[model samples]
Target: MSRFSLVRSAPAPTPAALAAPPPVAPPAARVESKPKSPARDAGLDLRLRLHAKLIEELDLAKLDKLDEAELRRQVLGQVTEFARIERMALNARELEALGASIYDEMVGLGPIEPLLKDDSINDILINGPYQVYIERRGELELTPIRFRDNDHLLRIVNRIVAAVGRRIDESQPMVDARLPDGSRVNAAIPPVAIDGCSVSIRKFSKKPLTLEKLVEFGAMTQSMSDFLYGAVRSRVSTVISGGTGSGKTTLLNALSSAISEGERLITIEDAAELQLQQPHVVRMETRPPNIEGKGEIRQRELVKNALRMRPDRVILGEVRSEEAFDMLQAMNTGHEGSMATIHSNNPREAISRLEQMVAMGGLNIGADAVRHQIAAAVGLVVQVMRLSDGKRKVTHVTEITGMEGQVVQMQDIFVFNRTHTGPDGEVFGEFRATGLRPRCLDEMIRRGIPYDTANFDPSKVLG
Candidate 1:
């Protein structure tokens, strides 16, 4: 029987005839003597088995022909009829939850559907069928969600990849993709993963974060935002450098909002994630090779193609490969206000990394020549990083001041002084200028871009 039997632990001070003890002591009395607790229902296993049978009996042909409303009605009818046949009983809430789970298993990524719908979950990492983890509010926690087995996990992965017109198998075990909502997804299976399929999803926010919002989050100060706005307006070729998950793309999205709506912008990425609200923006993404290993479109080709598209500014999502050379050439060539991001910790490291990437382009140029090109092409490198307490901040606003001797010369006008951490583990620091007047200020003013050098005085600190 699915019904719960409540047995009182203590004798009743006042009793009625209906409460009389059973002719033979009640079966529940043996358990009530031990502890005072509510009775646990024993129908959980039966309900699970019934759910599986219903799913197995589902007719895909009939299901496919119905609209959402019709589908829900049909599924609900089948569930209710099945429960009646099995002599099972469920409360209203339990019935609704089971209906949702069945629908999700048939139509979505089962077990993780709720996580995907949660706006607060920033990341969803599925190690295998038996374990699922999610990142919420910058903290990682294990979840009770799981697939039936490894094969079940693989089925979901295949469904996701197939929707994107891609596939991952033994021959090609790792792939990058995006969900319908534009969340970035990466999957590695079997041999490389060792355990099973490993899937990482970087969730996309529906509302793009703004500079004002970032200030509220203590990501940057008002003065810093003003300086960046002025710099972008001055048509400075800028690059954002940061480690992974350092809010490079989020900051870039915020910065791109400052671009004049009149200008045409072309953005390129392996997976398009930037949400530029400008009306005249064109976005493109690279395509991977087919199963036979042919027909690949790399970012380097896109960079070369963007030159002919008459773009007022080109936004390379990231400069990571031979494309770095093409990106530099674009900046040197008349697309002076172009912007891109690179993976680096500091300005000096970013410059060195760019130089190395230039060589990666197979250009037969010495380091000095590459540094010369960088010095003339790039104007600023803004370094951002995630603090220990899970805060992201613009750490440095550096100016590339031409070549000094054999190296590229750069100076940090503003920097985050990460002096120490507080007792609560919050990063304690202040953003301050390095006391050097930016040479860009003079050029910015000359170009009719309003810039005030007073805000960058070295003696003043900003937080």
Candidate 2:
């Protein structure tokens, strides 16, 4: 048996030590000395006897050896026996209701319950019953909550997997699921996790990130926002790239808000996170297979289908797989100004990562061909980063200048320069213009859009 069983079965404290009462008489005398009323006598005959019997049967040995299904079966059987012996009145529905209450009280709330109620806690990570963590306001911290034990945690894991129509056992032992609120969940048990069962939940926010909020947080200046608005309106295909938890999605959402309302937009994601204000928006999400291991719809498949929908722009939540190829093809065709995000350190590395992803699509194309496609497709790469001082900023806004030989060329149109740092480690950076306006800005001016070169000149504003 496990050590938990030994702890649970430890001897109880003596009555004198537990209370300030006098020494009790012998058990038989104490029982006979009690003043009995009709209600007390009847209640004792049923509930007290049932409680004693249950305590005897629920000893540590029986609990440690039983699987979840067997334990549940035993619990139901005991409930039925107690009801029948007491001649209590209950229908099937009432009995099931009682069973659920007892189960919750005995076993504890399952994995996702605590996470659902916590608005400040953005993420919940479970590394078995003994170790759990949560992310709050971009920082990860450990939590004191635990499952009943490893077996209890496993039972909750199994319920989640089964609800998603997936399976996780020794063979698979890993799965991804989404909660009813659309929070993303990934689980890996035993052998695979190596540190007992593990679960990671990325919480969903019902209210999407907005540009107004970004400005209030000092993530970017209003001039930068105005420039991006012009870029998106002029159909400059942009990619927002950043490291994990670096506000990539938030920036992407803010940028997409600049898209003209007349155009139809289609967004594809593993879990839908984008909040577009336009009325003509269609959202598509990927799906895992059923228990039969069929009917799975992947991101690549959705990307291809989005192409056929005659969309004005295609928005992908994140490009981590071979779907980057189709996304590039769509952009290279007529879908200019289409936007998505990728994981990369800087704008230059974002292009390299896109090229690598295109190669993974099983295409036999040369690197030169891939670079050409990327250059012609992606017009701008906006790199966002969260610095050590807990400030998120747009580190680089780079424009693709086209391909030179086999290499893709990019020019930084806007860059953040750290002007000063105080003794408290707070950074002060200025977003400065590089004097190289995008080639498409001329097109925007020709299309009757007003242009003020003075606003684009950072020196004029700084002075």
Top candidate, metric lDDT: 1
Q: Spell out the clash pairs found in candidate 2.
A: none
TM-score of each: 0.85, 0.71
Candidate 2 positional error at 67, Å: 33
lDDT of 1 by residue, 220-296 (tens): 88888877877787789999999988989888989987789999999999988888879999998898899899989
Q: Relative to the unseen true structure, what is the C-alpha lDDT of residue 155 in candidate 1, on a scale of 0 to 100?
A: 84
Q: In model 1, what is the error at residue 392, expressed in angstroms?
A: 1.0
Each model's lDDT: 0.80, 0.75
Q: Could you tell me how far off, in angstroms, the CA of residue 223 lies in candidate 2 after the best superposition?
A: 1.1
**Candidate 2 lDDT over residue span 348-404, tens digit each:** 999999999998889999999999999999999999998876678988889898988
Question: Scored by Cα lDDT, where does model 2 land?
Answer: 0.75
RMSD vs true structure, all candidates: 10.7, 13.6
